[model samples]
Target: MRLADLTTIGVGGEPELIVDAYTREQLVSALNDAWDGDWFVLGGGSNLLASDEPFAGTVIRILTSGFARIDGAPEGFQRVSIEAGQNWDEFVAWTVAQGLQGVEAMSGIPGTAGAAPIQNVGAYGQEIVQTLVSVDLIDEGSSEIVTVPASELGLGPRTSELKRHYGEEPARVAVIAGITLDLRVVGTDPAPVADERIRAALSLASDDAVTLAQIRERVLAIRASKGMVLDPTDADTRSAGSFFNNPIIAEADARLLPESCPRWPVEEVAETVQVFDLATWDGQVPRVEAPASRVKVSAAWLIENSGLPKGFSLPGSRAALSTKHTLAITNRGGASSDEIAELARYVRMRVSGEYGITLNPEPVFVGVEL
Candidate 1:
């Protein structure tokens, strides 16, 4: 299987075997077999950075399909179970149509529902943790299917127990089968009210009276403007969403910045990390969050301030920063994964050298490390 074919970036090499599972039972069996035989699990490939070299192992593509309302009180608080294979945007749209209000802000994120809990996927001031009730996982070590609640999973900004492997090396591999989200069924009017809050927070609303559907549409438009939404015609959309998780730093560290830095509640910040915005030497602003009760900083600001422009490139390079967004690194047709990795490394090193902070990558890397 060509990694390029599986990824949005369209630059990876190939895998030895690619298995697509369409049913829960099949997904479980495949996961068990792969665990016993030592195979890698590949999901939507949205948040991945793969190497250009061929992967010499089994690649199991989760195609499990199931969407049902398993439990709901008469009052309208319900639990919706979704398989990992369902496209996330479609799921969000379905929920919105059903009068659900929790996931509307996350409407345009790429990938599957199963991947949501993997990184606690969030956007537009909302995260999966707020709505996720439980996750159905195929325990790779035990080969048993278990339903773990959100608390048991240790969900932190873009990090989860499923993401952090236990035993042996910490960051090993684990496969997710499905996830259950607790959704609130509100009146159509209520949805619009909730959407008003979202739009207000995102600054996409000129007035506070936008309808729910209109809020969703406008948010999608905003995301599309930044290449956050998927687009076949735009190479800028050919990325694993944001390349770096906003950096969270200590409060003491944040105090070093000027008073203009934006500060929000720790909980509003990802990972209980106090976050602050940084003003670049060139006047651009970047936001950062610290997961350990500190502040998060912006890597994009650091990159640009550290002498890299939005479209920074080495001489005769095909890989460059996305002109639409500074945080994203793009494949400008025929670029290799190695070139991307080099660019990423260059950005990280320059930022660290200048700011005395290390920028961590947000995407999962397959057959490559930076």
Candidate 2:
């Protein structure tokens, strides 16, 4: 089947073998059967940018769906387990309807629940790491399923150990069968917004209180305005969510950027200090302190400053930047995979030449190079 019809970006060639697994057992069998050959799992197909060249391997699509409230949650939280194939936004909607408070700010993200932890999926300031308790996983060659804790996944800003970047291999090769999340049990009650960005976007005061449904409504609306929420009618949402991630750079490098560029400090561990008794100490020198902490700079700001603006496109090319958001490179009707790649390359080159920083593509590339 053509991956173009399957993916959100609507760009890709065909796969040699397509395996649709509708149950956990079938998924396991498919994975085991393809273990010795070239294979990859497909969930919602939202975070991929496949090539026009055909995929020379088996593609396993997970279609299983289900979720249930499990026992044994902390005092004010409730634990729920979700299948890997469940739609992400639908799950978020369910959470809001039930008045859960953790994932409300991440309402309109695409893809499935299983893919969340792979990239530490997040929006505004709400990340899966905040509430993810555990996941049922199986390694590449293992026949048994294991429940892995969230802490071991190496979750970080827009990345996790399992995520395969543009030209890098993941630290682990495994499939998540399901995930468990611990969400606050605040049914129909108002909760204070903890994320500064969400508060600013919603125009809520620091002391203001809002319901879970309210938060989800506002987040979805905001995403729609930026062409982030999926809609067949909106060509701006035709591409993979974000073309590039916000770059995290060293403090010195961040300082070299223009003052108007937006940047945020990344939390860093404080340097360890060693103390000795002055009276009984030997003549040993103390260790020097660590360098300044890193900061994350906005990629959209860099792109616009580098001579690329919203709706910009190369002459005679169908691929263009989204008119609503500069971070997205949209497929205008019949754009080819090569056209998308060309636009992405041009953007990267311009941004690098202007800011001396390389912008990395966020989507997983299959049989495609930047």
Candidate 3:
């Protein structure tokens, strides 16, 4: 089957072989069998841009699904283990229906649950890192499955230790088999939303009463309005959720942008000191200082201000910016991979020339470059 047939963007060439793994054992066996060869693990196929040229490797499509309540949940929380291949939206729906609170704001995101931690998936102020407890996976060159805590994953903004960035290898090479989350059982209770971003989007005051169900409903509505939620009838949804990450640069660089540009300060995390062996300490006291804070500027703002408005496209190309969101570069039906790449490159150049800040893509590139 063509990669396009499986992906949300609908524009990838066929791989030499496609293997679907519907269970954990099948997934592990497939990985072991393809360990010495070129292979790519495909989850929901939502965040990818594969080349039109045929892939000369195996594509392992993860189809496993299931989740169950497990022991070891913290006070007032429940621990749930989900298979890597479970549909993320379906899981979110289940959580909301059960009155879980942590993931209510991330309701309409596409892709599988397994891919969530890889990019530290966040939306409407909720991130996977907030609830993720641990993951089960097989490390590279190892045949046995092992559990690793969330701390070891180096989860960050749209990045993780297992994520392979453009032209660089991941710090760790492993395939996730399942994940565990600790979620609060708030069940259908109306509570004040703590996330300012969510409140702003929903137009709710700080003290406004809202239920988890309400939040999910609003979040889904917002995403669908922006063509983020996948629907075959909506051509605008035929693209990776977001083409570029919101650029996080040094505070000084952010100051150079137009005053109207939206930006937020990245929180500074305090460094954890593991040990302080006084016996080996030097006589002199060491000086302590904090680094400068970073700022995250809006990519959509940059694109629109750089003379590329919503629905912009090349003269004769089928690829165009989503009419509903500037951040998405959509496939306007039958667009080639090159067309998508071309539009992305042009968007990057325009934004760079206008703001002197380079925009980085968020999707995994397979034989496709910008």
TM-score of each candidate structure, all chains considered together: 0.86, 0.96, 0.94
- Segments in model 3 whose C-alpha atoms lie over 4 Å from true places: 269-289
How should the candidates be ordered by TM-score, best one leading?
2, 3, 1
Clash tally for model 3: 1
lDDT of 2 at 100: 77
Winning model by TM-score: 2
Give the poorly placed runs of model 1, Cα more than 4 Å off: 72-74, 164-173, 190-199, 204-207, 258-293
| lDDT score of residue 253 within candidate 2 | 90
So what's the TM-score on candidate 3?
0.94
Residue-wise C-alpha lDDT for candidate 2, range 42-158, written one tens digit per residue: 999899988878888899999989889998789999999999999988999998898777888889999999999999988887889999999899899987889999999999998
RMSD in Å for model 2: 1.5
Local lDDT at 13 for model 2:
89
* lDDT of each residue in 42-154, candidate 1, tens digit only: 67788888888888777888887668888653366878899889898888888877777678888799889998988888777788998988887776665677878788888
Better of 2 and 3 by TM-score: 2
Q: Identify the superior model by lDDT, candidate 1 or candidate 3.
A: 3
Q: Residue 125's C-alpha lDDT in candidate 3?
A: 79
User: What do the candidate models score in CA lDDT, each in turn?
Assistant: 0.75, 0.91, 0.91
